[model samples]
Target: MSIIPSIFGGRRSSIFDPFSLDIWDPFREFPIPSSSDLSNETSALVNARVDWKETPEAHIFKADLPGIKKEELKVEVEDGNVLQIFGERNVEKEDKNDKWHRVERSSGRFTRRFRLPENAKMEEVKAAMENGVLTITVPKTEAKKTDVKSVEIKSLESYIQVLIDVLTAETRQNRVTPLVSVYEESCYRKISSEFL
Candidate 1:
């Protein structure tokens, strides 16, 4: 009924042992498998789902971590821009004979990380878990203007192409061309006729 893994005990032998040939031994010396690897093999592991919301003042994240105890949960802020939530739930069953038809739920460690907004205030962050829902609130910090910027200059080639496109589109409609395009075309035609 113990949840811990069972350990088998046996005598060790060297290759020089005459009576007990270590080479013929059933249990060969090998490195013990790590507990993390064993935990990964276990079929029961927890899965967490998360929901995010953004507001003008703050961004909120609501995560669903079912079957996990509050004591097992860990929450922390990382890298000044990320909030990490992780936890593990251990379920021990004494009845080994009972058969399980379907085991869809996870039962191990679960984690969820969220990126904070640029204006997020790390000091005012808060988290609460209720009914398997973990809600993390990060308040928005006041944004300061980095530097004064100038307006981008439009390329003359693109500007002229845009003007031609508008004029072409207006002419394709078979209706009267717009006064702006007509004036522009007449001006260009007059300049070209004078040059010719």
Candidate 2:
């Protein structure tokens, strides 16, 4: 049982196998899931894939629900903003003589919820299922625009002239004032930034 096939194919690898040119994955016991598993989380508790889009008129959602009937699906809106979509597709039980070679086509129940924006018109929300796809559209209202007033940009030349005049004035003795150090640091930063 210790011997197993390497990821590189027919090559056999064991615990004592050298690490060069051969990679031994520690999590090999768990097999990588198939594409069906990603789209539908299998029979136990299926979680289907859903797509959402927004347009000028409404917010639309498309859920992939292959081989599902209208009677098997449920769509609801809760608390005004949460849109819920849930459903299940169960296969009929067969006799002992009948065997299922592959069971990836069936899936169990799964619930998915989406938080709608304030502009969503939940009361008028509509859903339709066609061609293995469930599409839901939530009409939207015009959002209120906030009042934004632009401020005028004052001329910086006067400020720069004042700053230059203050910096060029003679200091009291040889003492390095805090303002002088600040100006020096800012000048150094500006010079360094220009080079970069």
Best by lDDT: 2
Candidate 2 structure quality by residue, lDDT tens digits, 94-184: 8999855545455577789999999999999999999989999999998789999997664554445555556555334435566785785
Residue 43 of model 2 has an lDDT of: 43
Question: Candidates' TM-scores?
Answer: 0.46, 0.52
lDDT of each: 0.69, 0.75
Task: Report the poorest 10 consecutive residues by lDDT, candidate 2.
Answer: 20-29
lDDT tens string, model 1, 41-147?
A: 44334336678898877888887766667888888889988888888877667487976653434457767777776788877889888998778888887677699
Runs with alpha carbons beyond 4 Å of true place in candidate 2: 1-45, 96-99, 145-196
Name the 10 consecutive residues with the lowest summed lDDT in model 1.
21-30
